[model samples]
Target: MTVVSSVKDLEALTLTIVNEFDAGVDRVWQLWEDPRQLERWWGPPTWPATFTDFDFTVGGEARYHMTGPEGEKAHGWWRFLAIGRPASLEIEDGFADANGEPDLSQPSGRMRVSVEDLGGGRTRMTIASHNDTVEQLQELIEMGMEEGMKEALGQIDAMLAE
Candidate 1:
């Protein structure tokens, strides 16, 4: 088990934001590491997600395909850099085309997730995403990534609170 007694304070860099969810650290970690659980809460409410090849471990890889409301398909992958059990996770994440090949022109990012158990059955999950540049951050903003994450995490809260 990862020691989540310490809270991590992160500076907001290019497109960095911290979201706190009121759930146990272990519960939050389960929502993160389990592909089925992620698919339940990780996509837009209009479009359901289906995941393939998900392995949550250091050096492991995951691939996900989400069908948009307009019937368009989006794919992505993450190369896990670190997996701190129920406490933290770090990974290099990127988007790919339908065939599962990297699109170099798309912005890639490094994401670090710190799970701090706040006791009383709550956990503050902070996500720090480092993009290549400010331009990349702006691009992601234009792509509605922030709102998407917010909505997904909101769904996570709803699901976990059950």
Candidate 2:
């Protein structure tokens, strides 16, 4: 997501996050698309994530079971849309059970990710997710999406640095 602010109204806001990692584009891409590598940085670093039946591609699905700080389990899935190796990927995210069947009505919306080489063995990663309506955006906010993503991305950055 790129950050944009409305000059007309200070209350109108948009999220724009730009992060560069100390890793090559291909390496970062591989880490993102691979289930095993994803496990290393999919959720909060302290909690760790476990994946099941992960397939990264158009029409493919991925299931991740994350253990919370209190040891509670929650599962989620991603339905792939576009996949361009070492460049970009688009997908839909949602909550799911152990079987990877998502509730279509309560999804997290479509997310588009772009990866670019930033020279010096660095890769820039950008992610944007647009909900279907303002209601959904509010729902996402209630669900703590922003905080979760910050934690997730923070873990990713740590993995890339390592």
Per-model C-alpha RMSD? 9.2, 9.1
lDDT of 1 by residue, 1-162 (tens): 233243333343434455566678898999888889988877756556677888877898888777765677777778899999888899887777779776678878898888888889877877777776667566444333444676788999999999
lDDT for 150 (candidate 2) = 63
* lDDT, candidate 2, 1-162, per-residue tens: 223221221132224345678889998888778888888866656456788778876898887777666676666778898899889988887767646567566746677778899799877887666565666566445334435676789999999999
lDDT of 2 at 73: 64
Question: Between which residue pairs do clashes occur in model 2?
Answer: 1-127, 2-16, 3-16
List where candidate 1 sits over 4 angstroms from the true fold. Answer: 1-13, 104-107, 133-162
TM-score of each: 0.71, 0.68
| Model 2 misplaced stretches (Cα beyond 4 Å) | 1-14, 98-100, 133-162
